[model samples]
Target: MYGLMSILVHSIMYTKFITPLGIDASLNRFFEARAIDHVQVLAHEIDGRQERRQGLKEAAEYIKAQLERLKERAGSNFRIEIEENAVGGSFNMMFLGHGISFGYRNHTNILVRIVNSYF
Candidate 1:
């Protein structure tokens, strides 16, 4: 009775102080219009003394909170989720997939991956 759609969001943090921010809502809109049903977030890295910057735990929590906020804002407009199980102090990523079968489902599939260093 429905179709299948997929959206992939890949994020890589190669240095210290990598900021893991949520994807923009406008980007979600684009994906929703395409009837995407799955979102894959690839967050790589954790507590590692790669650089003399903020604590790894602190940064991890910050990233988690940011993602939670996005889910709350999305409400029913989109079905977003985060995958936090990375290895080593390397990559950080986030992905959001939306499904809009009744409304717009013929637009572009947007993949918004926001990354920041020394934040």
Candidate 2:
């Protein structure tokens, strides 16, 4: 199973030129160990479905819980939007000169968006 690192909700803002604020910015100094714990949880608890294509919703729920926790710790004026939906798609690829085609069916997709009111 692959592990996950604890992520800051503001880190999402970095994608759009936003920086962490107050307690959120200071978290990396104190939450280094907590990040490792997150890794362990993702590697174990969430592995129940992550290794397969069937349990993404469970992982998404876990992520939502984490985000909620971070939201509480964030300074101010930051809003988080977490979106989940059932999505399906297909793709084709070449592997070792062999034709490979795959499809996503009944798959759950989760998207997170961070909105900074100050901006």
Q: Give residue 84's error in model 2 in angstroms.
A: 1.6
RMSD (Å) of each candidate, 1 decimal: 22.6, 13.3
lDDT of 2 by residue, 54-86 (tens): 456677677778877777766678887777787
lDDT of 1 by residue, 1-119 (tens): 12222222122233356344335446434444222322211123334423443445445555576567666666453566566653333333444654333322222222334433323
lDDT of 2 at 22: 41
- For lDDT, the strongest prediction is 2
C-alpha lDDT values of all predictions: 0.42, 0.68
Clashing pairs in 2: none
Question: Can you give the TM-score per candidate against the true fold?
Answer: 0.30, 0.60
Candidate 1's C-alpha runs over 4 A off are 1-54, 89-119
Q: Candidate 2: misplaced stretches above 4 Å?
A: 1-30, 48-54
Residue 94, candidate 1: how far off, in angstroms?
Answer: 30
lDDT of 2: 0.68
